[model samples]
Target: MKIIAMSDSHGDRETVKTVSNLSGNAFFHCGDSELSFDDPLLEKFHTVRGNCDSDHRFPSNVLVEIGDKKVLAVHGHEHDVKRSMMMLYYTAKEQGANIVLFGHSHLYGAEVEDGILFLNPGSTRLPRGGNEATFAVIEWDKTLRISFQNLNGEVIDSLEIKNFTKEH
Candidate 1:
């Protein structure tokens, strides 16, 4: 399975559309879209509510199943991601998720700890910490291959997980 993840668009509909159009079997928007829940462009994504999103219709978190993996998606505000990922990690672990997706600080990063993958796709409209506008693609076969890419699909960083079995 291939999954495209993005977040923190901050009302830039065009960028959201661009990322959503990229090649992937599943799409996720971590939040801060600042768009209505009924927006047509958002229809393709499994989205969460950002602090900037005033619409109560969007959920604060979402759980998605892909292949044999369970992915937990959130905007990260409730867990205080700007401070630390500890809370998010524990929450995902408790939920039986193998992967945790979140966005709050507008910075792109990915890491694996205790057999779980944590990813932040960054801000496609407003990047921070010297990072460019970015998104992430996760390809799962025998391994989990994660690539952080620029708007033009150029890779900025990549990670590979060779031991991500379902038992983990």
Candidate 2:
């Protein structure tokens, strides 16, 4: 399955539209979009609510079933991700999610712990930690391939997870 992952756009609708133009079986918006829940531009996304979001229509978290992967998507603020991911990790495990998508620190990162893949696509509007604004794409099957890209569709980083399994 192919998936597009992005977060923290903070109301930059055009950038989200541009990035969503890419091909994918699923699209995920990890929140802080500052867009309405039913915004036309975000129509294709499985979105969660961010701390900055005022839309009551947006859920705090969302569960998406992509291929054989159970993905849990969150904004990270309510879970205090900047200080620790322990709570978030527990939530994912409890949800039976094999993949967790989140954004808040505006930092791009990816890591696997005890068979679960956690990804932060960074902030497309205001990147932090000296990184450029970016989003992420994933291609998963027997292996997982991740690509972090800028608004111009330029790849900034790439990673391949050959050991990520469906059964977390």
Candidate 3:
């Protein structure tokens, strides 16, 4: 399965559309989009509510099942992600999820811990910690391959993670 994850657009519809156009089987918006839930572009994404989002129609989190993997998607603020990922980690564990997808700090990063994949796609409009606006593509088969790409579809970083899947 191929999954595209992004967040913190802050109203950049064009960037969101661009990222959505990428080749992937699934798409996620980690929030802070500041766009309406009814927006056509958002319709293609599995979205969560961001701190900046006022759309009550959007849920605060979502659990997506892809193949045998369970992915937990959230905006990260409720879990106090700016401070640490500990809370989010525990939450994912409790949900029996193999992957946790989130964004809020506008910084792109990925890590594997105790068979869980934690990813933050950063901000597509206002990126912190670097200049390049970024998103991530995760290709999962027997292993997980993550490619962090720029808006132009150029890869900036790539990570191949093995043994990161939760045993059934």
Candidate 4:
């Protein structure tokens, strides 16, 4: 399965729409979109509410099941992700999720620990810790591949997971 993950767009509707068109089996928005809950572009994204999000209609968390992968998506603010991921990791473990998607620090990164993949796609509007606005694309079959792409769809970074795919 393939997945597209992004976060902290901060209301750049055009950028969101552009990323939404990328090919993937599933799509996720890790919050801080700064868009209304009823926004048309959000229809195709499995989204969580961010601290900046004033929409009560948005859910605080989202669980996505793709193939054998159980994904837990959150905005990360509620779990104080900018400081640490311990609490969020515990939450994902409790939920039996093998993949965790989040954003809040506006930083782009990915890591695996205890057999779980954690990813943050950074902000596609207002970015931090990097030069350009970015998002992520994940492709999985027997293995998992992640590509961090700039707004213009140029790959800036990439990663592959082999050992972690047993449960994915």
Give all TM-scores, in the order shown.
0.97, 0.97, 0.96, 0.96
Which residue pairs clash within candidate 1? none
Give the count of colliding residue pairs in each prediction. Answer: 0, 0, 0, 0
Model 4 lDDT per residue over 1-168, tens place: 889999999988998999998888899999989999999999899999999999989999999788789989999999999898999999999999988999998989999888888999988988886458999998877778999999889999999987556564
Please give, for residues 4-69, the per-residue lDDT of candidate 2 as tens digits: 999999999888899789899999999999999889999899999998999979999999899899
Give me the runs in candidate 3 sitting further than 4 Å from their true place.
Answer: 165-168
Model 2 per-residue lDDT at 69: 92
Residue 130 shift from truth in candidate 2, angstroms: 1.3
For all candidates in order, the CA lDDT equals 0.92, 0.92, 0.91, 0.90
lDDT of 3 by residue, 1-168 (tens): 899999999999999999988888889999999999999998889999999998889999999997788989999999999999999999999999888899999999998888789999888999998559999999987778998899999999999976555482
Which residue pairs clash within candidate 4? none
State the lDDT at 25 in candidate 3: 83
92-157 per-residue lDDT for model 1 (tens digits): 989999889999999998988888899999899999999999999998877989999999999999
- Positional deviation of 155 in candidate 4, in angstroms? 0.6
How far residue 10's Cα lies from its native spot in candidate 1, in Å, is 0.4
